[model samples]
Target: MASRVVRGGHALTEYLNAAKAAEPLYGDIQKHVLEAALRPSGRRQDVLHPSEMVKPDWCHLAAFHRLRLEVEPAEKRRTTFTRENIFQEGHETHTKWQRWLTEMGRLAGDWHCAVCDGYFWHDTTPAHCHECGAPSRCLTYAEVPLNAHPLRIGGTADGYSPQDAALIEIKTLGLGSLRYERPEYLERYTVPTDVGPVPDLTRLWRDFRRPLPSAVRQTQLYMYLASHFEDLPVDRTIFLYDFKSTQETKSFVVTYDESFSGPLIEAAAAIVDCVATDIAPRCNINSGSGCPSCLEFEEQK
Candidate 1:
């Protein structure tokens, strides 16, 4: 099937709609659980990792957990971290930042497909019209009648290799006390067979999770999907550059697999169904706190 992936504000709207629809069922529960999770202790004053400050979606968190599981064994056994481990750590931040930034950027027309011409919300103005080769100017939200659900798709490649028409994703991190002055760190880190090492996973994970940004993941996803669908060979690399200490940290290149999409598609489908039916699905995993909506419904009993 053609990818229905949307970008920018339209994606945010769909997510918000899903959240709103699920509110009665899962919103309050999620909020309450997050509140507790954020505050592991009774005191709410305790600070959290900067990345934790931004509430990441379940998919990003789950992906990170999966990545962690892949690496834990290596770390436990004192073996060199594999390419997969580094990739996961680099990806953890990418997923979190992409969602947060995309949502925020929607406020300023930052979200839209780079490939197509139509606005995600309204199909009237064509960014590029086929008939006259005339570019349809983007009308401000105020000027144009917009659709409740805008179509968001497409993204510009950051590190594109024009010669090969390949997109390269470089994931990086800033230098820290430990990583700094350690030449061996870069050698031990893994890279895709295409890209060279010099990119360390351990340090990348630390930085990636520290300050979350958005565009990174969106770009990666778009590139991955576009390459996959177009049957193009795209080079995706994550360069872990340590800005704090001014060092070129580590880099890795990775390819996507069917396993990655299985859960995401399932989650997206579930959310879409919930929005369509206005029915929140049950949480398969018991959170132990009990379902608030159900508890309230029972209180009336």
Candidate 2:
């Protein structure tokens, strides 16, 4: 039996189109959402983010240009509304899952007690505890900030569970298909284009068994930082991929591998050196690709 998956956007468009006929406020609501999408939020940190480091060769030149922009501010390209909406959706998905875990008492986050010189579990830091009283100083977890300050690298991991000795990372992916659907043998599945079936360049649906390389790298870095910063047994990570359309999930267990992060940190060091010396590294990508860094570097001269 051949597994069948269908793009979810088309069906959603049809339903939305029909619903708009009855909903008078739909246009206004959409306008509000679009405005929210366009609004820029959060100050950009110049440090190397785990998410940004997964690109080819760390896309070091682009990163260098970005860090430079912080000091020499300039107008930079903005991502499209569609892309922004995708990010917003991913954030919402993470919140939804984490909240569910907390509600079910399965999500345990670690907190440090300065007085006892120990760690405990709770959603947030408490003002006082039995051992630690009078303005208890503590560090709480969940979206816990982890960093290698000397290396200029930092990021927040999704969640941590002391009980399982595992770190949690949530990912949201577009519904590339109805995962449960299967087609009879010899039945048509995908549109036959002149080139071929829609290019599954990432093999997203055709081979959905494994996590994306970028996601794995991001998680590996988080695990590495968690183990070092908190002394937690972050030898393993649980990656939960939630499909946006159906909210269906697929989970994978990734064990810590020094082989994955050693090169990442090494790359970060190279980029840091380039920035410190005020010398731009040679572009790892072709200038013909219109890399912003290449253009910015040329303009700086």
Candidate 3:
């Protein structure tokens, strides 16, 4: 037992020595990361994507600023590496699921012609581009562009399944969102219950769950645009939320409601109108309704 203790002590000392030797290296790497993150990303804010159409009041101002920036170049504010990393992770999650759906032959939607850049829904006969007569070999559905021309909103839907006649919108949610949405979730799941001392991670998802209001609005807008543009009669959306920690998923079938969606479109139209007139709307930053993009606009103004 004394020999064993001596060996353990030696191992601990080796680890401590190695960690001490690596301290400067780790510090250098962290400095580089922070510097890279702080560097202006130089990303263009040309169009206000559909996902960004959340705050109604800020929409017009944000859109107007984007248009103004097109004429006058400006440095865009850089987000923290943590927040940007989360976004990248969410994008990877969406890509993985979409790729899986494609591999499974479960994903459906219109085919985009690589040759002429035309879009046509999948049909019984051999698919071909209507505009340029490109064969099906030149068609793809990945990153399909969608536009609400009237509202001047554009974004790519995650996926679509003709079988269910529903559009898909995938979102990755971290524990922070759960804390905001259900503060009791962590406590209830991580604490010892009547069963045992170990945390019951399986019960993490409980009642009192609904899709984010912004997500619903975004999905509804997608459905409306898909139906109106493609004539696919898409009136429903499959809103899938993937938990980052557990890799578990919860889904909601969001049916499009004209009552809920109408005002959103109207709000988008107002933004477009504001942009057309080159008259910026009042800033909503003071009202606690602006996002990072809105804040950038406020700063630029």
Highest lDDT: which candidate?
3
- The C-alpha TM-scores of every prediction are 0.32, 0.66, 0.66
Residue pairs with backbone atoms closer than 3 Å in model 3 (clashes):
none
lDDT of 3 by residue, 78-122 (tens): 344355567779878887877666666667756678888877755
Error of 3 at 2 (Å): 60
Cα-based lDDT for every prediction: 0.35, 0.64, 0.65
Candidate 1 structure quality by residue, lDDT tens digits, 9-52? 43334334435654476554433333232222332111111122
RMSD each, Å: 18.5, 10.6, 10.9
Q: Number of clashing residue pairs in every model?
A: 28, 0, 0
- When sorted by TM-score, best at the front, the candidate numbers are 2, 3, 1
Flag the better candidate by TM-score, 1 or 2.
Answer: 2
